[model samples]
Target: MSLAEKLCLTAAFVFFMTGLLTGIWKYRCMARSENAVAPRYVDIAHRSSLMYSFAALLLGWFAGYSAYPDWLNSVAAASALGFFALAIGTYIVHGVLRDTGNQFRKPHRLGRSTLPAWVIHAFMIVLIVAEVGGSLVLGSGALIAIW
Candidate 1:
């Protein structure tokens, strides 16, 4: 397998494991809650990790078929994978802290200090660009190779 494929598959496995662990955490939270509901962020973390695992698998499949060189494909895949990991990690943090249900709500404070709205918006912009741009690169390469 190409380096990009290996990297993506590895990430998929890690994400899947994280999802499982988070699922356990969710169960624990639910058991402790009077209403038997897990914290919103814990559920979000579990769901996101599971979804990202499949997304990583899709990326791996594309990377394997991509016409681009290994280095280029790896770089492109890494961009998206990195963001996916970052997002999952953030969710896990919020789950642990039982923080705001919405990270983008008014004030937007994941940390002690209220984050500026611009920073949150900027992060969303970069995340969209990285994930979409990187997927386009690999997907286009795969299409080119097949056609």
Candidate 2:
């Protein structure tokens, strides 16, 4: 791959590693709690999010780096952010929604998770915007300056 491609790949790989770390921390938090999330369920979410994130990463890299066009970079960067933020965050939100959905079951205090669902949604939105904007600026500039 070209230098630009390599740079994008490095960025994505770094992001993925961060995601992995976040996943591990979240699982650890769950495990310590009385109402711990199951490993199997966590695994499923992890795998799903990882796959989608990887897809976004690769696609964005190729489009931004290989093609090196403004529009292409914009598209790929936005896509990278969207898929990574939404798809991964969705799994987490859905899990909480599912757990809380059961009216009959009154669960324990889930630390800061006691916050309303809207908060999580809003956080995800902010993260997405930041990622997309950041990626576009960084990737686009890199393509221009380096490639």
Candidate 3:
């Protein structure tokens, strides 16, 4: 496997570790008080991290199967990894800081009006486009190779 693919798999492991930590946090919160519930963002972060990890693995495998150029593979892997970290980190921050309420259930007002929110959303958009666009190009190249 290429270095990029290896890195993607490593990211999957990291995300799993993050989930484990979140689980522990939840357990502690429950132990402290029967009525205490783990922060919504923490739960969302744990679950989404797992999903993103799987996505990273799938993208890595697709990149390898498609025999994408080194540069393209690198870009796709990097974007996937970047998005994964950003998502998990944001979740952890929101959970720890408790700046907003139940982000999973309701849209935060900051997302609609804040400059920082706009920058973060824009960055996520760019990463998604790069990762998906690269994957499509690589998949097409593989199809052409087969034909």
The list of candidate 3 runs beyond 4 A from truth reads 102-117, 134-147
Write candidate 3's Cα lDDT for 4-95 as tens digits: 67777888788878878887876776677667776677667777777877877776676666655767776767775776788788888776
Using TM-score as the yardstick, the better of models 1 and 3 is 1
Off by over 4 Å in 1: none
lDDT of each: 0.91, 0.55, 0.69
lDDT of 1 by residue, 44-146 (tens): 9999999999999999999989999999999999999999998999898888776688998988867566788999889889999989988999999999999
User: RMSD (Cα, Å) of candidate 2?
Assistant: 8.2
Per-candidate clashes, comma-separated = 0, 0, 0
lDDT of 2 at 41: 33
TM-score of 2: 0.42
Alpha carbon lDDT of residue 108, candidate 3? 45
Model 2 spans > 4 angstroms off: 1-15, 22-41, 97-147
lDDT score for candidate 3 against the true structure: 0.69
Task: For model 3, give the 10-residue run with minimal summed lDDT.
Answer: 106-115
Better of 1 and 2 by TM-score: 1
